[model samples]
Target: MNRVIKDTGSKYPIIQAPMGWIARSQLASAVCEAGGMGIIETSSGEIDNCKKEIQIMSELTDKPFGVNLPLLFLKDDSMVKFCVEAGVRFVTTSAGDPTKYIKVLKDAGITVYHAVPSLEGSIKAANAGVDGLVVEGTEGGGFKSPVEVGLLVLIQSIKQNLDLPIIAAGGIVDGAGMAAVFAAGAEGIQMGTRFVSSA
Candidate 1:
């Protein structure tokens, strides 16, 4: 099969959403083992704690995985540097503009994926030179856009307007949902609720 996302040598396009406080090492490791990219949420912003989590994840499996960094908590470039030093090859940035850290992560040869809730945000992130875009729709839990666009609509909108690969998120709960996203022109799908149940 032709997987949509190609980062750090992993072939599958799917990414397990890095739900803070819910996405534990075991869960993340499980996804990676299943041929999809797993991500640990280090939203805590403490470099030391993040490092420990990275180490724990590393021990679980040697497969490539990523870390989610909330841009709001990162300061003074510590989190960026920590990811680089920790040898993480992929990172998903959210909660703030991720453009500022693009060059830093790119220089380290890390692939940076930014999250967006609207077409405008997707365009901005693409203009900011993100390697990929995770388009989160209204059905997604946690903080969401006031516009409340659904995944299907957002995917089509992003694909029409942006050249960057799009990772669709929100209300995806099964293999059928995954297939539907790929049919809708999403390069990949990010699943949060489904993974929680899997764990």
Candidate 2:
């Protein structure tokens, strides 16, 4: 079985990828109730809000949910410790080199997944021992590669290069998009814009 689904308990093999200000407790909880893993974003380093959001989510579903911590944006591990203490088992790191913190996360018994925008980033995260990878492309909204590589093209470029479970992101808005990426070798899909727009 794919570790993504095993760890997340997402029935649809999909993740409601954290979208900074947009993916707060309301939208995230809705996705979790819908059978997909919802993620709370901590890009602002707002640990208190994250705590409140996680609390609300816990009230909505028993399924495993996740927290997204963009390592590049935070100054310390205070939030990480909060997640650990809060019993958050799954975390996704993006926008920074996660190597220095991977051990901390893993040692805390958390499953770490890194969101990467290129093959180089993917390999680094894989070597950093992130349990999985959210391989996003330029087509996705928010911070991304200016290289303009399409999602499938980026997936194909790095899929065979790494041993980690790959969760394809960007350019996925519907079932057809999901099926196409799976055929392209992704173990799961993470969609942001589609979910945010719907909310």
Candidate 3:
């Protein structure tokens, strides 16, 4: 079995990007129902509303889903505690050091993937003990690294250095794009722009 499928528990090796307020239950549930992993976003820092969204996801789709923790945007660890207590099985952390909450989330039995923009970041995340890496390239929308490495190059470079399951995120939209990433050595794909239109 694909490690991405084993890690995410989604039928497809696809994850809907957790885009701020837009990545709420309504959008996430649809993705889940379509057999892709849907992720609720805490990046918006609307903690209470995001929690409500997570609950709504349970009622909306029984399919496996996830939540993203944008460490730079988070004001506290309350959301982490919430996910742990709520029994969220999967999570992706970005915008800060992966080492900070890795132990707690892992100890809770959560499968954690950290988003990284460069080879150095990917290596650091792997060393920090993340289960996988969401390798976001320069083409990806929203926040990005100062270094502008493209998706294919980033995925290939990281794959050569670290033997970790990678969920490539960037300009991928259709099957052709997915195939391109897979050929570049990524095990899965994460789509944000396409899903924004989906929502």
Candidate 4:
């Protein structure tokens, strides 16, 4: 089985990008039902609301799902505790260093994948013992590095330097784009804009 599928426990190697506000129970549960990994987003900084959504996701779908922790936006460790207490099995950390919460999450048996826009970040995440990488290229929407490295080059560069599973994010919207990322060495794909319109 594909590493992403195995790690995520989803039927498809597709992960929905945890876009703020948009990535909640309704869309996430739908993604889970459709066999893709659904992720609850904490980027909105609405901790209480996000927790409610996580609880709602449990009632909405039996399929495995995940959550995203954008570290930079966090005000405290409450979000981490929320995920661990909620029994979340998978999480993607972004907007900060992966090392900050790797041990705590891993200690709770959560699989961790860090979002990165550069090879340096990828290396740092991999070395931090994250289970995988969400390799966000410059083309990806929302917040990203100022440097403009396209998906192809970014994917190839990370794959060449690290053996961690790469979930390519940025500019992928269809089967053709997914195929293109896989061909470049990514094991899975994360789509934000496409999924926003999808649900």
Candidate 5:
């Protein structure tokens, strides 16, 4: 198994990225049960609902799973505290400075992954000591910016500069695409559309 999968205890190197608003426990646990890393989206500011869904995920699968917390959307530490108390071991943070929560999560023995859309962001995240980086290409889907890097370039650049595990995200919806990213030096692939579409 790839380091990313092994680190998260998933049977496969595929990660179902928490695709904004739509990512919930049902699909997240299903992915986990299917041997892929699954992530619950908790950026909606609904702490209660997040806990409820996490509880549901816990009941449905014994496999490890994670949560996606968009720093830009989260207003406090409620969700973070909740996950830790609930025994979540992996967390993927996007769209904000990771320094704020990276230490908190790491101190509690949690692996943290930050989604990066630019080389600068990748370097910064690596410096912050993240467990991994999810290089989200403009092609995959993310914050709309005139400056968007595609997976090919972003993954290569990150691989060339960073030693941490890399998970490729964006524009990949199948095995061929996953293989291409892995060949490009990514340890895993974070897929959203394939599962979201099927759901």
Candidate 6:
């Protein structure tokens, strides 16, 4: 539908955020089936288990989905390599500097997206040459920054200085919020808590 993220073959700019402890293959598959990108959050276990989840999710849907590998647990290069080998084309990294793994993933031909809570973090990710930035505000559930920037301000701040496509996360619940973010200059939007409560 002519979204910046859609350029990568996703039908919708909407992404089902990887909810770590709550993420499942079924949930990720459902999002993909619904014409949105789903992401498997692999933060709770070993690389092998994460690899298995990716494989299972891939088997469940031919559509493009992604895996979230928070840098907090990336102890070795094997996890990144495992993602590449598992045929995961897109990755969202959080909790640390994405630069350390940028070249490795890029060389493997995977699109890298970093999650940031501030303009400074966004700038750092841009400088590292990530494909996109998911600008998450404090309202988003889970490990949030204490800085307390809301969606509108955070989105605008990142938009002003970053060249990469910006995806707004936190407090977006439906189509109206989605429309608003696009109008605000974000190429895409990510919603975590909203999806978790849906029937």
Best by lDDT: 3
For 68-119, candidate 1 gives per-residue lDDT tens digits of: 8888767778777888887888999887887888888889988888999989
Candidate 3 ranges beyond 4 A from true positions: none
Per-residue accuracy of model 6 over 1-199 as CA lDDT, tens digit each: 4545653467888888988766668888898888888888877755676677788987798899888888987777777888888778888999899988999888988888899999999999989989998889888887888889988888887888866888889889988988888887788888899879865
What does the lDDT read for residue 27 in candidate 4?
Answer: 95
Greater lDDT among 3 and 4 belongs to 3
Q: Local error of candidate 6 at 140, Å?
A: 0.7
Worst ten-residue run, lDDT, model 4? 190-199
Q: Write the per-residue lDDT of candidate 3 for residues 121-155, one digit (tens) a residue.
A: 99999999999999999999989899999999999
What does candidate 2's lDDT look like per residue over 94-132, in tens digits? 989999788888998999989888888888888888898
Per the 3 Å backbone cut-off, how many clashing residue pairs does candidate 6 have?
0
Where in model 5 is the C-alpha error above 4 Å? Answer: none
Q: Flag regions of model 2 displaced more than 4 Å.
A: none
Model 4 lDDT tens row, 84-167: 999999999999998899999999999999999999989999999999999998889998898788889999998889899999
Q: TM-score each candidate.
A: 0.92, 0.95, 0.99, 0.99, 0.96, 0.94
> How would you order the candidates by lDDT, starting with the best?
3, 4, 5, 2, 6, 1
RMSD of 6: 1.5
Per-candidate Cα RMSD to the true structure, in Å, reads 1.7, 1.3, 0.6, 0.7, 1.2, 1.5
lDDT of 5: 0.87
What stretches of model 1 exceed 4 Å from their correct place? 1-3
